[model samples]
Target: MKILSIVGFGGQGKTTLAKAVYGHLKPRFECQAFVPVGQNPDIKKVFGDILIALDEQTYTRPKLLGLDENQLMGKLNEFVKEKRCLIVIDDIWDKKTWKLVRCALQESNCGSRLVITTRIYEVAAYADEAYKIQPLSHDNSEKLLYARIDDGEGKYFDSLSAETCERILKKCGGVPLAIKGAFLAEELPEEVGLLTQLVCLRAGHWDYSWIDELPEEVGLLTQLVCLRADDYAIRVPAGFIGKLTSLQELRISCRGKDAIIMQFVEELGLLKELRVLKITRICRSESIESALLESLGHLHNIQELQIGNYSLSKYRVSEAGSLSYCRHLRLLHLDRLVFSALPAWINSSLAPNLSYLDVQVVVVKDQDMETLAKLPELSCLILHLTGTKLVSVKLLAEGVGYFRKLRFLKILGSLIRFDVRGSECNSSRVPSNNTIMPGLESLEFGVHVRSLKDEKLQLGFDKMLGFQNLGTSSLQRVKAEVNCGGASTWDVEEAEAALEHAAAVHPKHPTLLTNRVESQYMISRYQEV
Candidate 1:
């Protein structure tokens, strides 16, 4: 089979180019199918679409849904084996999906053709001839933008000034999709309300100065399975969320008082189906009432919870600190909370299903580490240790094992940054028989070079290399970010070289990313795919 692939970023016209090619080639082939395989695709639906495109007589109903992927592919292969088919798979996201789809498109030895369109480079590399979609030229982009807005002839275009047209074209960013969406004539009605039987609804904080609150009509959408609202200026209408009994996910980021906010948090107990919930920027002076805390415990179906920056200074931190009630919680993130130590309820009985835990704590107690090691299902841990002095503890110290299933570790904030020049800690701190996190596949750590004036900061490359000697030979990738005040080229190259040497002996050829940036945290660095 002959294959042609088009690859580029979103809005770069990969789909448009595929459509154009399909239009030109469909007439020449005996059978053709153009299928859109989005980010999350069902292979059965894709096979059905291919069958319909080829005008094949096949039963596509609820009964067919029970067929496994292999069964579906087998039926599809039989239909297109002999025909000179032209198949286009659009917007493929990953190789695993492509491999599954490719197995069904067997080589007929009858001059069939395949075309793939994707944003990922590795997927495009599978093609015999791959073309990278380039950004539109200045002249072509202007022509396209004018064509979308112009009234039939050039009369409307002649009325506009050169300066205004130039300003509009500049915002298009050399992308045809952006240029096409630039100008529109109609404006929405002032008094607007969404009315639907939708299973999901997302409302933005539209013009906080003008729109203070959501329309009362939002209460009508009781069938909502997921709701996302980011409104801070006004309180959500009382008893609003209590109606969405079917809601599986709820995400809200806004500001309100203790009574108003806790009242809503209390209402969450009514959502028996809730699996994921996130509440951010909730300001409350009084501690959460025991009754309200008990309300959160009723959400036994909850698997994911995120509580960020909830200032509860007056409340006893330990009263609501333990999450033993959330037996099914799989992912939890607690950010900027004042808790002296790890809560007592973090055992396997409290959150046995826990897979990911992200916490930003004031201090990292030794016993806290010991407690974390006991979680059987835990696979990823992200810790943001706050105190400057207490942050420099060695993670690879002997006998610190509890992370049997842990695959990824991300240490952020002050804990990652170290004042190497002034610290009394020496290289001896690196455990000679260090044996922690033996199963880790990825590690992202940062260093504070914020005060490295005159480049006096010795980029700790050798010390990093010493980490490779730790008991965990499974560590395959390491990402190190240096806050190099204003990173010079010299600093970046030196740090990268050190990481390369450290992983040189690794059997898996571990990857090392050294991000040298001026900010407090390292900015993300780009790598060739």
Candidate 2:
């Protein structure tokens, strides 16, 4: 029996140890059980709750056997079978509860490990081994502090202003919670106020929870309004992120001015552990130098990659060799791009793993459309494009229906033109009857249409007006828009009618459709309201 117990005081890392141990050992065990006994306990009730964590499917009826101490021992003995199992009783206080349960589970085999964490040393001694987990090392503590700091708008604190770092470290005393709360306080004067409050607190009396600190910073959420920035060069000092090898999600929003922040954009490649990386607006030209998609290949575990406004500029599809690197990506959000249709290199339909894709690009070609259309696992798509050059909607008419799990779709602009003999929308390019998007909830599109030389119908809008797919889609919201070619169509009569039509089709909901020229229609989506 490889039994280990972790013991520590009230705020020490007891729960973290159990979680880490389980994370380490679960794949090895045929069956694993994790039980958390809090500071106060009803031993009987905690044990009864054990069934929920165990991965047992056969037992449909979960019976809570309220056995006496002796009967409980028998029940535990009966509970564990030949399979190598794990039983963790956390925060145990008394010897009576331990002796009975310990004796009962003792019949299990050598590979079976038992882990328990409690503050009381006697309870810890009952186990075969123990570990004392202390607070953060100076470096580990500071890394967390610097990562979340919003250095004053103009100034970047790489080393956190020499004196400030020292003062914070001295007062916080290596206690992680205090360190976080202290640095997060408003001004130097407020820090002094917090310190005064701290000195008044009796030993072991301060509430360590961050939730307790919410009221002080709650107003910041509403007061914050961001002005556009080309890029931001925030200081990500070594101590803040040096040891973050397992780091997955990274969101560095640049609410700064119109300047290049290569330090922020380029350093991403170095963090081998990065998965979900989100950065605000960067000029399209910034990416030509960026080995972005390539650097992210190291993060094979990435789920989401988000970029803000004007990020995806005109790169040929061939330049998008980076998309190939993200093998496991599920969600891609391109917040606000200047144009439509993603660059050509991104035209790989082979990303079978993608699920949710949202882009604000305005330029997309037929091939890019076809490649994205074929993604089988793609469930939701929100593309707010400004321009599209596809000659025929058949590419969509053909491909979108094949997606079995597709639920939400929003496309903004498209061009219409196709030849009859496989030259325009090739004979083989048509979607089969079953290929229509069936599970759609929200669809918004605009296409350029040449009803004649004198008029251009936003073809995507026209298709949505007539196209109806039943049994295949359970659409809850549909916003179809058409470009009337110019400003003459932007009248009150047109807006109200379109809005009224939207209200009637989705009558239960508010207005869903709009008709306008390209500029107003595309820009409207980006407006927050």
Candidate 3:
């Protein structure tokens, strides 16, 4: 007369531990219920909500709206088959809806107790006693982060700083809904400048907690149009971002000091109606990258610009066209800024509505992939290639048909060498009648095996001709990582048997995620050949 299943994953609380064991055994049940069954469940409204929670004055709501699902599971198995029931159910997602709600629960030996909550481990292995729910111990996650920042009144958790409560419990890693949304309150209550018509404020915790300063009454939030304080050890005082000149979205992460991030990059040229600018941990200096390229040449209504860490290789192509007045630039993320080329204002007449491009480069030519495949609304490309000398870039299967709206291609590097020129091969290694990125769907790459007794740094995966010229039929997913640091073990079994024989001869047979790693061991491999 006990079912019990709790399982985890998904904020790890499992419906708050099955509502604390159904409120400590629902006063020794005589018919109790608590139902949720989400992820699209409406099994006749869950058997008419368990027959109106087992007898609401004889199943109310017009007696179960003219009963359906097998007459509301035959009046919920004849009223829990003679009483003493305590059902739960809550969030069970599939096992054919838990065998259609376990055929209306009939096994009542009068001490009946069901209780279920899941994230799916084969529906908690059909519960007889499954319970998996772990996560909350580092002394119960610092007593639930000081009882949620003092209601247990330890005076704001005794004024923080045990390195900000171990960086807010190592960034709320034990996840009680991320420590109840990490409200690291140590400051910012100068009566928050009476919320002067706050248009949106969003503080801290995007990745970690840090709010050491920002209260110059948050520049009296002059109708802030969206100011996300994405914590890089916060601290913004001096002219708090030019009084948020009606900011149209500015995510921050300035690491501080360097004259307060060069006076927050000269007050970001008074945010001329900035259309989403994200600045992260910046300050690699050269006078804060020439005052952030002179405040990105006055953000001409910049549309989604992200500039992180620094290093635009001594900018010159007329100072890297200071984002050539971002003509409504659509999403550009330049994180580990490394360009040595590929800048010249990222063409198509200065970013004609560029659609998502992340960059980092030391080399990538063939006119930097034909100036990023002539940009007509380029769709998602993340290319990194920091170079220390092993270059080879070819990729010209009709220049991937000028990526007419490319679909998400990532390529990080450890001394590049892509090569996919006019594919035509076949000695039985299949793949390649040449097509590449034809509406590509998700392809990530990163290799670097370094020294498998260098026959020009032996790359395998059947000599990756840029993944056998990806004859895309909208490829669905292919990730590779490799890096067998100082190789061997037959070069990691010849790079995992040439990535499981190139995902068993790909042609949109996608889903191939390999990892490889080495310097002792690491292997991950997911195939779907």
Q: Which candidate is the best by lDDT?
A: 3
RMSD of each: 13.0, 15.3, 21.7
User: If both were scored by TM-score, which would come out higher, candidate 2 or candidate 3?
Assistant: 2
**Cα lDDT, model 2, residue 132:** 74
Please give, for residues 133-208, the per-residue lDDT of candidate 2 as tens digits.
Answer: 6877888767745543444342334434666766566656566555543342222322222221121111111223
- In candidate 2, position 458 carries an lDDT of 41
Candidate 3: list runs displaced more than 4 Å. Answer: 1-181, 184-187, 190-213, 216-228, 231-252, 255-258, 262-336, 339-359, 364-382, 385-441, 444-529
Every candidate's lDDT: 0.65, 0.51, 0.70
Which runs in model 1 stand beyond 4 Å of their true positions?
1-92, 100-196, 205-211, 231-234, 286-294, 310-316, 319-322, 389-402, 413-439, 446-466, 469-529
Q: What tens digits encode model 1's per-residue C-alpha lDDT throughout 374-483?
A: 68878889987653222433343335455667789887655332212232122444443443555779978765433332334354644533345422468778887666
In model 1, the Cα lDDT at residue 421 comes to 24
lDDT of 2 at 152: 39
Worst 10 residues of 2 by lDDT: 196-205
Stronger candidate by TM-score (1 vs 3): 1
TM-score of each: 0.52, 0.47, 0.30
In model 3, how many backbone clashes occur?
A: 0
Error of 2 at 102 (Å): 32
